[model samples]
Target chain A: DAGITQSPRYKITETGRQVTLMCHQTWSHSYMFWYRQDLGHGLRLIYYSAAADITDKGEVPDGYVVSRSKTENFPLTLESATRSQTSVYFCASSPVPYEQYFGPGTRLTVT
Target chain B: DQQVKQNSPSLSVQEGRISILNCDYTNSMFDYFLWYKKYPAEGPTFLISISSIKDKNEDGRFTVFLNKSAKHLSLHIVPSQPGDSAVYFCAASLKSGNTPLVFGKGTRLSVIA
Candidate 1:
């Protein structure tokens, strides 16, 4: 309850359907990030938020949308989930830029 | 292109021995480096970090060495135990806040007793 938490630990959705992955942090960190981990790729950042309303794209942002309306929540949305988007999603929160604490991760499967 | 590369997919080390994991980076702008340890189903936890100004940073049993000229870095675990077996990820950042980190594929360390 004191650290970051991710919702829907496991999910299976059809291609073309919209799916949202939720991330919540109790530390109220100023920086929050979303990353997807694949077999060959370790962790590619999808999006990051600096503050409540400031967000920016990372290495892999295509097809994924993120928003941070409040300091505690940063949600990632897949407008049209594709099979290629199937990967384990991770959410992290940091008080600064260097150190990060991650959630358990959400395993998303698209078919 | 991947800015950070961990080359080794996995490593095996005997218990009570030292385990060395290496990382290389292509970006010269990166000024900070960090190491993270991850379990099978858990997100990575921060292990150690070093700045460009210092070549080595040590904490407890974990130590990180950075070679700025070669754009290389390494994490060394002394007297590694079975509990130290996990996937280790290396990440680099250019600045603090807002900028996203570039991460390497990660190296899985297996400490066999």
Candidate 2:
């Protein structure tokens, strides 16, 4: 597809296990972001990448790690999942100052 | 502290009526604001945006008004339709580039026919 896509639309992992959510975009946007949406909190940015090999933390980056080895892929990893980390995760891509195009999202459940 | 805040948790509006959603921010450095709409199981989709330089920006039946002095902004939907019912989120950015957006809690809009 030409738009952004996320894999493992839904996931359930144990507390001590590591989980990774993948995001890929065909548009090759320069900017890619990861956000977690929870009740009472609309969307909190976890991490963002400006380009390949350039990534930075966002509002809520603790306990979550992100890396962008290529322009089309940005993956978020949870070293050790926690129950509080259960929330819907969204990936978005944008070109400079333009509006973002969001992926369908991945729902992660930490048990 | 939350830089962006949407006080209303939900709103009910009759079809063909105007739907107004308000947003407030504590950061004065924010220069751009945007509104996004999301369905039950989908990620938010960009609806409209307004820059700090302008007080208002309109597109079709949607209009966004920015009051920089008050650190407030609002999204107006005229003649709202049932299809417009969704969770709306307000976001702000310092400029662009590497500055990640700060989003407010979404407002669920229910447009009744």
Candidate 3:
């Protein structure tokens, strides 16, 4: 398609295991982001990438890791997954800064 | 601290009635506000947006109102439909084109038939 897409729409991993969530945008937007939606926290940003090889920590980034070696892909990695890390992860991209388009989402469950 | 907050967790409205969703922000630097609608198992989609320079912005049956002094904004849906029964999220940003947005929790709206 011509929009953003995410892989492993659903995942289940054990604690202490490594899991990676992939995000790709066909638009080649400069800015890409990862957000986790929780029951009470709403949508808390895990991390974001302004461009290729440029990534920054967002509101909540302790247990999560992200890398953007390419403009079209930004993947989030959980080096050591924890039970609390379970949540629906959303990948978003924006050509500019204000309006952002989101992908379907990846639901990850850590047991 | 939570910069943006959505107090209501869920709302129920009858079909053809008006659905009013409210949002509040504590950040003063945020000048741009946006509302997103999300359904089950899908990402949030953009619905409407309003800038600080204006008090209100309207699009079709959806309208957004901003109150700078009160540090609040609201999304009004006229003649709510069952299809509109989804989670609504309010987000804010600096409009500087550099910073990321701060999003509120979200409100689940159910348009009862």
Candidate 4:
């Protein structure tokens, strides 16, 4: 596929453990984002990166960590995951903020 | 506080009818609004969008109306089809740059045939 992609479509991990979700975009877009979808919360942004070396926190960034060392790849890591962190995680990219392209999403469950 | 809100959790519409999904935002700084559709196990795909400079934008069967004064926007699907059944989300952003989007809770639209 020529669009964005997420690895490990589904994941199960124990609380306090660490897990990382990968997002790759072939478009070489300068901007990338990590968002988690919960029942009533909709899609809350965890973090976003502008270019390869710059990153910023979003609405819910306390438990998640993200890095964009390369423009084509942005990875989200959950360090010492908690049960409340269980949700569907999506990665998106855009050359501009007007239109964003999303990956299939990763379903992460912390038990 | 949630910047973007979709109060309705779900909506049911009969096939061949019109389906309207509403969204509101608290941030007046948001200059762009967009709608996205998601299937059961898929990521959201962009549907349509309207800029703050314009009140309405249309593409085929989908039309997005923005009420700047009300700080609200809506997506209308005319003659809804079964294929339109999915979770629809409304999102907003400051502008088209490095900024990230703020999304609504999403409304599940079920088109019954």
Candidate 5:
């Protein structure tokens, strides 16, 4: 129970509504990432943070926003969620380079 | 353009046999390669990884072979078991530090009993 955790394992939202998926890690990893997994897209990164207050865009970052105000927390926000954004979102943290630890994942559905 | 590609979307292997999962990358700058396994509705967990400096890295029943020249890599699971059935993903990164990983579409591996 000491690794990473995601809130609301399952979520149902409506289009044009805003939703925030939370990711928290107890390991205090220096790096944190938000990735959305779709059928044929594998895991596409939405955003990543190097440390607190430092974030950058990834492959798909149009409607999504992420902030790392603390090293242990990285929350991804979907501003005005759309049906196309429905996917399983995963949060991962890494203290080093090669190995990454992931949260259970949050299944978000926009109808 | 997908930087990492997993041509085979799915692979079926019988129990007690070998399960080979292949991955390829278009970018030669990628220096680190890794494999992860994901169960339904769960996040992927790191399985094995091989750096560009090495061609092979082994851990228990999982072995990763890196062919730098071909820009290809493979993961081998020996004597596959039913529990090994999951979606296997291949990822790559440029180098150390905060570089995020580039993941392939993944291959659904079914190890039948």
Candidate 6:
């Protein structure tokens, strides 16, 4: 209730289908981020929001979209899912620029 | 290019022994470094952090040493226990900015009893 939480802990979708991963935080942190973890890549930032209605791309943002309509919600969308996009997605929130708290990641599989 | 790198994919150590996990960063702009521990099927949690100004920071049995000149850092867990077995990740961020953290691939540490 006081930390970040992600919806659809596990998801299986077909290629070319649209998918959205939801992230919510109760802390009302100013910064929220989305990252994907792969076997060799570790965790690469996809997108981040400094505050509501303001979003920016990170290291890898291709084929992915993110939006922060409210202080507590940041949702990531996959316009057209691909098999290569399968990975564990983590959402994190930070009150400041330094420390971040992560939610239980959502494992996504594209077939 | 990978700004942060963890050379070791996995490491094994005896219980009650020292466990050292190393990390290297190529970017000189990074001034803040952090270590995180992740369990299976869960997101990583922050363990410790050190700024570029300070070479060492300690918390409980976890200590992080930073070598700015070498662009390297290490996390030392003293008297490591089986419960400490997990994937450890190193991350870096700019000193004064909104830049997101760059993470290393992570090293899986196992403390055998």
Badly placed stretches (over 4 Å) of model 1 are: B96-98
**Can you write out model 2's per-residue Cα lDDT over A63-107, one digit (the tens) per residue?**
999999899999999999999999999999998634678999999
Report how closely model 4 matches the true complex, as a DockQ value: 0.78
Task: Name the top DockQ candidate.
Answer: 3
The regions of model 6 sitting more than 4 angstroms off are: none
TM-score of 1: 0.97
Better of 3 and 5 by lDDT: 3
TM-score of candidate 3 on Cα atoms, chains taken together: 0.98
Candidate 3 residue lDDT tens string, A1-111: 799999999999999999999999999799999999999889998898888998899988998888888999999999999999999999999976677899999999999
Off by over 4 Å in 2: B96-98
Q: What is the C-alpha lDDT profile of model 4 across B1-113, one tens digit per residue?
A: 88899999999999999999999999998999999999999999999989999999999999999999999999999989999999999999888453678899999999999
Cα lDDT tens digits for candidate 1, B1-113: 98999999999999999999999999998888999999998999989989899999999999999999899999999989999999999999886433567799999999999
Model 3, residue B12: C-alpha shift (Å)? 0.5
DockQ each: 0.75, 0.64, 0.83, 0.78, 0.73, 0.75
DockQ computed for model 3 against the true two-chain complex using alpha carbons: 0.83
Model 5 lDDT per residue over A49-79, tens place: 8889989899999999898888999999999
lDDT (CA) per prediction: 0.93, 0.93, 0.94, 0.93, 0.93, 0.95
* Stretches of candidate 5 exceeding 4 Å from the true structure: none
Q: What is the TM-score of chain B alone in each candidate?
A: 0.97, 0.97, 0.98, 0.97, 0.97, 0.98
Q: Estimate each model's TM-score.
A: 0.97, 0.97, 0.98, 0.97, 0.97, 0.98
Better of 2 and 5 by DockQ: 5
Candidate 5 yields a Cα-based lDDT of 0.93
lDDT of 2 by residue, B1-113 (tens): 98999999999999999999999999998999999999988889999999999999999999999999999999999989999999999999888443767899999999999
Model 6 Cα lDDT, one tens digit per residue, B38-94: 999998999999999999999999999999999999999998999999999999999
State the displacement of the C-alpha of residue B28, model 6, in Å, after optimal TM-score superposition.
1.4
User: How would the candidate models be sorted by DockQ, starting from the highest?
Assistant: 3, 4, 6, 1, 5, 2
The C-alpha stretches of model 3 lying farther than 4 A from their native spots are: none
